[model samples]
Target: MFRILAIAALLSLPATAYAEKLANKLLGAKEVASQQAPMPIGSYAKGCGAGLVELPETGPSWQAMRLSRNRNWGHPEMINFLVDLSQTAQRLGWAGLYVGDISQPRGGPMTSGHASHQIGLDADIWQLPPKRVNLSRAEREKLSSIPVRSADQKSVTRNWTRTHHELMKAAALDPRVDRIFVAAAVKIEMCKTAKSSDKKWLQKIRPIQGHDSHFHVRLKCPAGARLCQTQKPSVNELSKGGDGCDDTLMWWVTDYLNPPKPTKKPKEPAKRTRHPREYTMADLPKQCLDVLASP
Candidate 1:
């Protein structure tokens, strides 16, 4: 009787829901193994990390936020790079870096929030530089990142500063940085103020939505770890002297930034459809299962 009830309960669930439940079970583990060597597998959007290292919660020139998520883990190379970058920012007269999510211990699809940051090579750095590094855990969670975009989202606000520009520029120029994603307005601002020689670095800063509060940095594939995958080149390759201020920027500004109202039609009852595909253990590289299973 008990076995029959258990089978009936599972039959009541939708097929997609049942699949997601099984995927959750495989990815639910978030602890790192001390004995393994750090290796990144698959692409940034669908990948996993092994032998991850955690960025210190507090550093002389940086502070990691959202302590409860335990999302500060990353490849050792990335951790070292962030430490060096923060120290450089301090020397450049910026107060300090307020770092955001890096990747989970066994870098896989997060339960919520982001589609990337799954390969241990991506990180979000807040627009508001840390005024102090001794912030309590509670304070870090409650602190808000200052938005750089203006009310209309057509330009940067008053709170935007030269220090912000310098900090972003430094990060873009770093050899390991593949690209830095920011708001269109921020990219426009950089294009306007950039010196002739500095225009090259502008290519590395790509504009995207909802980055007014923080810029995302994605690192290039590391020296090793052959199992990892790379994203296909963008339609307009930035490395080929594409500052991205052409039709692409205009599309984002005119279309995405301020889209037209939807055309109203006769009202129709909503229809049920399958949920969009979600990444599961099978969607990731075969080795990721081993990464998740590791101590």
Candidate 2:
């Protein structure tokens, strides 16, 4: 399997490629995209992108916030998708979107924050619908997204609006989207209101932890991206075409929020996993070397 080979490669790098600098540092230093034709070179958490483009800092319907981070860049398709979604946000009664991080100029592991945005296919959209899209750089930096989930992690807050639901629904309906990550409480609130007859789109609105302030959108690999990996959905029911409104989804609130105490401690210590920030050139797909070296 591809994952097995990727691990094998970590243990046995060619002498020439061994001891190369951290991929995050090497790739993160790039302030612009590569000149090569557009391609996503690996899996979401382990890949590098080719020919990524910047989402303009400001658009009629969107503003890329936290400009200091210089994270407005993304795959061209992702840029287009964000622009389109911002307009959708405007139609839903918000002024427009206040966009968050997309990816570094040439996608790869980041020096800080986000393990999966490495592919330029993952993006974080603020939960705080913009009150105005023309905020100056200073105001943008100070603004914070509102929490849509309750402090108890059991229900949505007053900030959770009808527009938020519709916005997420509209995004889920988009064929280009692979999945959207929202807080478990938010997903539970949405699932409660969903009509059993029309819940198919809800399948893509995946419930995850700590996204109370924003929703993360991940796109399916673009056509002709030969090296792109297709990640399977987490829940088995989703693959069978069921709306993810079952007991499994509910488990997030009932068990995850209040995990049962360990009845017995394991005799062996669990292995420590390496974070993407620790990945080196040799750890990535072999082609990433060319991507890193490309002009």
Candidate 3:
């Protein structure tokens, strides 16, 4: 009986350990990639990518006719992303909170330097009104009798700015999202404000430069997107100075980011791949063997 009980305990240990490891793995998952090629630029069929969580086949899924508001083709998971995003935005006090740029319909040279938007999960959002601050209006008014609504309206609504941080935070938290590319300046601020939890989460987003105009958010392909191509994260690179946003933080390249231009031509690989076999004194020519021995 004692030996049998010991054997049973040993068997249970593996199962318990495996369950724990799986839980940890799920929690630590930072990014996911598609297992197949992305759908071509104008395919209307749904489920374009593979290796992602599969979704329903019915109507009103995500990515309906390029605009997210459409009722058809809006998957529940995608809808969940928008819902969570909008809720988070409201909590953070943002306006015109929505998803944009479903795909890179135009296939030529683009500003983002990649075909990230082609997969149909990325989005862009605008800043919220300052009147929607966390503080009470009476107290805020007492401190400064100024209307922030007007100022917010004057600010660019479609471009990148500090106010978009709410959206960045929302995207970073979503498990479905693969990565986000935001303005260099905005990223700098995020790095400064990033908490320990956010710091771990933000590792999934690959920050790059030249995004001040608008941020690019990319999603990992879901199982429903049958032909969607897998997106890979870019390598970390050094940053050149600009607005003096804290330069100490490390950066990863989101799908929308690009490799920095080299200051000069990089050295080319040697064309001759094969080399002569190494020679040993025993195999040396007679003349060379005598000369070498004389030394």
TM-score winner: 2
* Alpha-carbon TM-score of each model against the true structure: 0.84, 0.91, 0.43
Which candidate comes out best when scored by lDDT? 2
Order the candidates by TM-score, highest first — what do you get?
2, 1, 3
* Candidate 3 lDDT, 107-186, residue by residue in tens: 11112323333224554432323333333424332432221122222222334445465567667777787677654445
Tens-place lDDT digits, model 2, residues 58-152: 89999999988888888888999999999999888988898899998888999899889987898999999788888999998898999999988
Which lDDT value does model 3 have at 152? 20
In candidate 1, how many Å is residue 165 off?
A: 1.0
- Model 2: how large is the Cα RMSD against the reference? 5.1
What is the alpha-carbon lDDT for the whole of candidate 3? 0.38
TM-score of 2: 0.91
Better of 1 and 3 by lDDT: 1
Every candidate's lDDT: 0.79, 0.86, 0.38
Q: Across residues 1-295, which tens digit of lDDT does each residue of candidate 1 receive?
A: 5534544564466877755653334554555543468888888877788887899999988999998877898888889889988998898887678899998888878766787887789999999877788999999889989999887778999878888888888888899888999988899888788786657777779888879999999888888878778767776673577766665467867788788776997578789642212665657776776665555
Q: How far is candidate 3 from the true structure (C-alpha RMSD, Å)?
A: 22.4
Q: Identify the runs in model 1 with alpha carbons over 4 angstroms from their true place.
A: 1-25, 258-277
Candidate 1 clashing pairs, residues 3+ apart or interchain: none
